[model samples]
Target: MIITNITSQKDPERVNIFIDNEFAFGLFYSTKEELGLKKGLEIDEETIDKIKVRDELQSAKSKAYHYLSFRQRTQKELEDYLFKKEFSEDTIENVIQSLSQAGYIEDLDFARIYVRDKTTFKKFGPYRIKNELLQKGVSKELIDLALEEEYHEEIQELVDLVKTKYSSIIQDKSEKRFRRIGGYLQRKGHSFETIRKVLDSIDGKDD
Candidate 1:
């Protein structure tokens, strides 16, 4: 087929190529120039396939980079994003592999950082952080490792949280008040054991 026309897309970096007077494909302007695609250039089906594959991979990588620019993403998050954009499985896999190799898709590191930030800033307990990491497609093992490394001071965190946020309930000094405090901490992802320890410490102070 002979290249019949080339038109610039609304995106200045992209262009549409027409072959035999029919819209053939859209490609990056740089790619078009690199391949020397222009009117009157003869192309074959094999060449078209090669161009499409190369362009698809490049487009997928570009989109992934843009998506990741805002924040770190889990592998599953990136995969879903690319899939939603209608990239083929092969293209998505290729992008994922490249990102992984470049250290942009480290689930373990992501989990560690997430756990640290949530625990330190959000006051989230291990259980809640674990659930969030699981939702983000982190493995249970990695979650456990991150929790172990970053969540070592859960008891102290719980103590501070209760003292700061539930002081009024503690002053009640009733069984009902303890239950209420326990419920609140549980919702914040603390375990029953940790909740009991905090309550015991408060009870001891009263004695």
Candidate 2:
């Protein structure tokens, strides 16, 4: 843990620190005066260890931020991901906290966005979308709120999907087309009553 080299760059206000022939970390300060970068200083083993810990924490935080940039992830999902990358538990927790503070890893926000996207774009029913969110480790409370708030949109979207899939066949006079379409909607995760109602609306059938 020897401070091998320290290089400063003017354009970006950054200092690159090297230890034992390995690049340890970079420090960014508003001005050269911030870090007191005077000469004749000896960095001992304890200081080097502290710097290494800080470097590792920054590295882990960068990794977590990049992963979140690609897509939203549940808390458990992120924990598993960081664990797989061999980050220490303290580092993982600190990185996760930083992301949450930056409005990145919000489970409730994720659940709401998931439901909205599923209802609007995927045209999935509440049951299917809710189950998917639950599988992603979303809590039941947010799932319930998502379903309750988006029920009408969810139902309409499912109905639209069923209609688009079976419009021509449902118009036929054959009962086979009706039953097949009903079963299709049911298998798509719509409730029985909802399927029946949507099917009947398209076919002008009683009950």
Candidate 3:
């Protein structure tokens, strides 16, 4: 096969490679230089096959980087993202290995950070945090460790939240008010027992 032509793509940084006067593949401009590709260069069939694989790998890596730019992703999240984009399994695996080696995708770290954000900023309870982490593909053991580490102050956090949300009704002395407080706490991830204790204390039932 002959490399008959190479033209700039709309992206400018990429070029359309033509083989035997037909569009064969698109490659990054840097790829052209790295591969020493040029017009009228003769390439064997096997070389063409290798070039396609290389190009796909490069493309997959670029896409992964862009996907991870906004926020960290769980390993499964990155794999599913690349898979959904139609990258070959081998390509996705290689890209994942590279990203992991580069410290871009660490499930343990991602889990820890996620738990911190949800607890400190989102004010979510242990149940909700665990569910979210499980959905993100974190392992059960890691999720357990993360929740254990972050949930030590759960009781205080729930107390603070209910106090603020029902500040005007704090001393309303109504069963409905107690149920409302307990429901809000339960929805936020606190267990029913925890909610009951907090509500009981709020209503002076503990006295």
Candidate 4:
């Protein structure tokens, strides 16, 4: 096959070579190497082709792993991320499918764990947690399932947040303390009802 064109990849170390307008090979080199020609290039055609295939597969896998390392991402999120990084559609699809089948890119499970950690550990509320899961590309059905089972835990979390924030209110003697505490919890995604109940119980102690 004739190398018709060579294009520099976004990665400075790599290049894409086309044969008769078809993608035929990819190249990796350092900046010190000569342009338009390869150095230390002693590989046979058969070896070069095999190396290209292996590199492509390895590159896709590396991208998938690096994407997952920061935090859990849904399959769709990872796909979109890889696409933005200029991976081939087929490669991105295959990588995402493989990761999902391997149980590494599960949207439902990710949503559950994410919700649990943020609500129970981080003290975030349901609305905030739900919105965060949506941002992570989790489906509404999965979000609903996680939320249904986590309501009591999240409520208890809200109670804990109230307790932690109560000291801030103790400094103010007037209604200012109650309003400030309410707004604070509201921003944290707690509803008016829960905040009111918590505040009422606190107020009863003051009476």
lDDT of 1 at 189: 86
Q: Estimate, for each residue in 47-96, the C-alpha lDDT of model 3 and write its tens digit.
A: 88888888889899989999999999999999999999999999999999
User: Which residue pairs show collisions in model 3?
Assistant: none
Instruction: Report model 3's TM-score to 2 decimal places.
Output: 0.89
Model 1 residue 160 distance off true place after TM-score fit, in angstroms = 3.4
Q: Write the per-residue lDDT of candidate 1 for residues 1-207, one digit (tens) a residue.
A: 999999999999899999999999999988888888899999999999999988998899989999999999999999999999999999999999999999999999999999989878887789999999999899999999989888865565677778888777777877887788888888878888878888777667422
Q: Which stretches of candidate 1 lie over 4 Å from their true place?
A: 154-156, 205-207
Segments in model 3 whose C-alpha atoms lie over 4 Å from true places: 172-175, 204-207
The local lDDT score (0 to 100) that residue 1 gets in candidate 4 is 47
Q: What lDDT tens digits, residue by residue, belong to model 4 across residues 48-78?
A: 5656555665677787898799988887788
The candidate, 2 or 3, that scores higher on lDDT is 3
Cα deviation at 72, candidate 4, in Å, is 2.5
Global lDDT of each model? Answer: 0.89, 0.71, 0.86, 0.71
lDDT of 2 by residue, 78-131 (tens): 888889999899999998888888888888878888877776676667788888
Off by over 4 Å in 4: 1-55, 153-160, 166-168, 171-175, 205-207
Q: What TM-score number comes out for model 4?
A: 0.67
Worst 10 residues of 4 by lDDT: 31-40
Predict model 4's lDDT versus the native: 0.71
Stronger candidate by TM-score (1 vs 4): 1
